[model samples]
Target: MSARSIALDHLGGAEAAASLVSGQLDDLLIDTDLPRPGTIYRAIADRPVKGQGGMFVRTPDGPAFLRQVKGLAPGQPILVQVTGYAEPGKALPVTARLLFKSRYAIVTPEAPGLNLSRGIKDEDLRDSLLEIAHDALGGQEIGLILRSACADADPDAVAEDIRAMHDLARAVLADAAGQGPEKLVEGDGPHTLAWRDWVEPADVACRPGSFATLGVLDQVEALRRAEVALPGGGSCYIEPTRALVAVDVNTGGDTSPAAGLKANLAMARDLPRQLRLRGLGGQITLDLAPMPKKDRRAFETALRAAFRADPVETALAGWSPLGHFELQRKRDRLPLTDVM
Candidate 1:
């Protein structure tokens, strides 16, 4: 979580309140109600009495949350915009600095990077940065949510946000180097929201104050056909992992001659596309039971031919000493299965 403040010169409490409600303020600005002779103000709503600081408000659509402070002394007008980075080193270092119209809250990391290649270690780098940023903000308002908080988030979406934040930070830092703090990064937040709106899947249904689906209908329709149709009586159990995803196939009651090795090979061949649609990568092992001896060679031949069409880099090998025909699919980002 993060907070920032800006002095809106000549804008009275009513005007500020309107701006907050109308989404004009960089974030929801909380009025401190400082009395001044020429500054006429009125209470538009029964705001919290004690803390002049506004409660945390999630920045429209981004993964970020924000708080606002108001009521600077007359003639001492200033604009402040504070942003909190929650993803640690994953937070784009350069983009986070540009989240303000008056001034950025602070450039901070979300967390220490977890070195996957090395032994697992946890370091609180973002915590240290937030502490520094809080001191700069005069200890008035601060909020924090650990990166672990985003555990269940869609990995693809998070990757995109991180990319965007990094890009914005880079642009701002470049300009600031030449112009100092004279210019402010503006409207980046709205653009982030627009990007999310455009990229979100069509099948997702968003409701107020509730979890919504990710994709739109149009985006999901194609996926519906991507599923590998199980034979008359087989069922599949999916197991996902960062390295690779494994799907278990049980040839249930549908032991028809039609469900022979040739038919099974055909189905397995068609599976690569569905796997791709799910953005599956790394190794995929399909455990299939033994078929009638007569069809064995034919099944092997067909399976090889089918795999030839897959866009993903794949290898189909024989049922192992363990009776599993292993297929390895290369990984890029998080698999689409995890995203969906």
Candidate 2:
């Protein structure tokens, strides 16, 4: 079993918690007062932005811009899902691609398929899960994707989750023709997000004040600072600005010939975890320590490997002309400074 342990407790809200791995702060999540991601809303198209090929929809929260669509009237109602956190004073990001996601299954309303997670490669196991999915779906046109968590999950539990998501999808889809804008399904809170996304086997502590008892709160305080301590006397500073997040790597007190390479590699490996904890995203520019061109491949490999395990979607935009690396990440949550 993994050494990861989850601490679920209240902090400034009804839903807030931290996740620890091997007794160290791995991730922190706090449900904010704003509308949560994945919330399904029956929205009315407000106006179409010229030349952008999109229209603004009056969501339950506020006006949301929907992309890649046409033939939208100002009063037409359509279903949209909250895509991610929006900048302050900006319209909430939303999309019409509605998804019903749970722990073991994800129900795609319009897409139709019975797909198993590729992580489960065993043919017999795949066949068994496929049978369960077929039985649960009962040949519905709605799409169902068995999550990776179902690989070793109990058959009955998986089936139940599938049926539940399927039913929810049907119910929500049925309400698309409603009269006015309304929230059909509220999104998952921080604690529910932890339970749903953190699928690795781990001990869970949900008693009151567990964050304080388990040192999660103390660890959280460190997030206020931009400097992240690295192994072997190295460190990196993450500072956010209006344009993008700037990360500068420093090999403190290490002057070896390979010092820059080592420090840069360490930063690349730990950068994803740090970003997740800090709840920072958008454009990221990394000013790595001075290293030879040949060493950048190693750093790039390490960076890619690090983010492969992160649940959030990130795009590595490659190195800039000035040797700085750039990345674009999803705004899944508010910045840690804003939350704390």
Best by the lDDT measure: 2
Candidate 1 lDDT over 1-340, as tens digits, reads 1122122221122211101111112111112222111111111111222463432222212222123434422222122233222222221101121231111121223232221211112345444433433343344322222232123334444344344444444454444323212223333332232222222122211243111122222333444333344645564555665555666665667666656454466556556545644555567777554576567667677777866855346776566677666776554223433333
Once fitted onto the true fold, the runs of candidate 2 whose alpha carbons sit more than 4 angstroms away are none
lDDT of each: 0.37, 0.90
lDDT of 1: 0.37
Instruction: TM-score each candidate.
Output: 0.33, 0.98
Error of 2 at 321 (Å): 1.4
Looking at model 2, residue 277 earns an lDDT score of 90
Mark the 10 consecutive residues where model 1 has the least summed lDDT. 35-44
